[model samples]
Target: MKDLFSSYRIKELELKNRIVMPPMCQYSVEAKDGIPNSWHQHHYVSRAIGGTGLVIVEMTDVEPDGRITDHDLGLWSDDQIDAFSKIVKEVHRYGAKIGIQIAHAGRKAQDAETPVAPSAIAFDETFKTPRALETEEVKGIVDKFRASVRRAVQAGFDAIELHGAHGYLIHQFLSPITNRRDDEYGKDLTKFGVEVIQAAKSEMPASMPLIMRISAREYVEGGYGLEESIAFSKVFKEAGVDMFHVSSGGEGPIGAAGRPGTHASYQTPLAREIKKALDIPVIAVGRLDDPILANSIIGNEEADLVAVGRGMLRNPYWALEASQALNKKVAVPVQYERGFRH
Candidate 1:
């Protein structure tokens, strides 16, 4: 039987355990230039030292206007690359694989003169109603995503995950309610998502894995459902996506139904369904705090990986503690050895 601590390899990267520090926005970057500072470096380095198998960096905007918050990290230029490279090296020293989630906020971009999306839809009260993107402008966003992937590879990240989920740029395109364009982009729901994957792949090293974070269900009327999400997964697989990071909600009409409440393994069923439909590995996320529940998801073939966000934020050594509870040995940094022994 495979244990949670069992090593798993995807392409050239090998995870030390099944634990993944799922991307969580820190909102802790330089506002003007969106460069990662010392705070970002130390935060991720600690997680690496805490024995996380894969430390996925927060959602990094591919362009200035793509930022969801004023303090989001970005990789739109050469200067930003140097700043992020420092943290990548530090995380690598702790023996963990690093991945960057490159994204565009689209209509969800906050505090911008004119946020761009497939249509002119506002995400919420906090965000401004976005300007519908022109066809030429849409092409520019694709180029930016490709460029960002190149920068991430140059910064020495082991892999890059395209931030397609969570009501971001790709989600804006995927949801019918948000994407009302009559052109090529909206006519084919899967077209834009597949293009981003291809563009990112083109800029990255051939051996490096590319994961697509997807909102498996919109959980609202006239929005993407499980059937459409499953069909979309096929397009992603054909586009060379190595894994599917399954998440739900965040892209729907105001006050939609079926939004999963905060509960243990709340989103595991989405992962299970997607995994059943696709051959690629499925990563389950959302309120996955308990080791028993995580073990059950993996043990029952529900998901190949479990991503813990708030849980890990509250406890950097959550993976280590969970491993101990499961009677498995995990690497502990020398500095934390005393606490681990106790």
Candidate 2:
């Protein structure tokens, strides 16, 4: 019987447990050159030391302007590769598998001189309206994704996750509410995402599984729902996605109809549904701060992995604490074993 302490395997990657520390941007890149600094090193290494099975690094953009902020991490240069490699080595020493969430912020890049998106639209008044990408330019973005994946592989990451959620560049191309282009990309909403997936796959090793994070339901008016997301997810799967990280909303402002409530394991059901419908593995993330609930989701076969977002932020040792609280015999570091007795 698999539980939170059970080891899980996907392709060539084997996790020590089911507790995943999902990507949450640290925004500590001091030089604004996409290179990660000491803060990133300490932040990720601490979680690895705390017993997380998998620690996914935050949304790292493929290009400088693709970031949500100037401080976000990036993978556009060879110079950035060495720094990420060091972090990956440290996390591995702690026995936690590390992955990177390669992303593009699109119109949400508040600091970009000229943010680019599928269409010339602004997220809101505070954000600048992005210039629409020409058909030829779209291919360039796909190449950038391929380059990013290559860099991740060189950095020694065990897995790769493409950020297609939260109204980012890939999500912008996926969402009909945001993608209003009349070009081929708009004609086929999944085209951009599919191309990106294929591009990233080309650079990945055959043994590594590519994970995609997607908004299963858009909360804003005229946004997509589960059915549409599943359809696009199917396309992505065929295009070479191995797992789905289910999340919701982030298309527009909160509205009566679009607002999804804040509750524990609220997104687990969506993951369950997708897993059953598509016969694919899933990672359920939301307010799953409680160990019992997170374990229950895995025990019930609802999701293959549980990503604890805010809980991990508040406490880097959330996984270690959960192991102790659940009375599961997880291996604590030799130095910290005295602090966490079974």
Candidate 3:
């Protein structure tokens, strides 16, 4: 009878509750350099005050050009580490574990520099056409990932999640529609992902949990399918990924079909299937607005954890309210107790 309020552990990390706040791009950074500021602190701190068990920071670029937008956060230099450290400390003070999503936007990067992908492909009209990365430069991107992981560790993050999904850099490599290179990287999509994981693991402590957010299905022609994702999951497991955040359908023309809709647990099946194929934990996300549905997925072993994105955004106290509905005790900030007394 594991409910939404039940405690869960992934690797050595313990989550006070099953409710997790999925990373949502705030696009609130100060400038193209991607340095985190007070806005990020206030944003995440508000979520922490809302009683989320875990709050995964938004996607942060490992390199300057890896940013998806000019306002995305980054960790390419030592100066950024202090801001991240402040964020981690603030979130932890509220009893919420904080994790950072380190990523490269790849072909999706937009701004001063042209984007780089496994092949020269464009994301959409809003996205800039990217140049294919050279072999040596690709290795540099892997190094950048390792460096970012090190910075996250220095910032005292509890875990690190590789942004492998959402039609970003890693997704670009994973998707056949964009990754048309014949080299080892483009020829074997799994290899590139494995390398990134290996690099991150090498830089970060072995005890720290490593999760990969992957689109289980591209939902477009010639894009990644569940079968390929399952295979990729196996490789990730062997490479020491602690969990898989199963999200889908970010790989087509911009605003293509399969974007977020009203369906509850739209990507749960992918998590279930991947979890069945691998021994690691799977996180189900997308339209998980109902606590009953979230509890059912966990109770039935469909997913080990449920991530709520827009749902939590619309109602940061969604977890606390859910606990109340399920007859479970939830901690409320003393100042807010009066508001909930009714």
Best by TM-score: 2
Those runs of model 2 whose alpha carbons end farther than 4 Å from true positions after fitting are: 253-259
lDDT of 2 at 247: 88
Question: Per-residue alpha-carbon lDDT of model 2 for 115-167, expressed as tens digits?
Answer: 99999989988889999999999999999999999999999999999999988
lDDT of 3 by residue, 161-249 (tens): 99988789888888888888888887788778889999999988877899899888876777767898898788888987889999887
Regions of model 3 farther than 4 Å from truth: 253-262
In each prediction, how many residue pairs overlap at the backbone (N, C-alpha, C within less than 3 A)?
0, 0, 0
True-structure Cα RMSD, model 2 = 1.7
Residue 96 Cα positional deviation in candidate 2, in Å, after optimal superposition: 0.4
Least accurate stretch of 10 residues (summed lDDT) in model 3?
253-262
| Local distance difference test, candidate 2 | 0.92
Tell me the whole-model lDDT of each prediction, alpha carbons only.
Answer: 0.85, 0.92, 0.85
User: Model 3 — TM-score against the truth?
Assistant: 0.95
**By the lDDT metric, which is better: model 1 or model 2?**
2
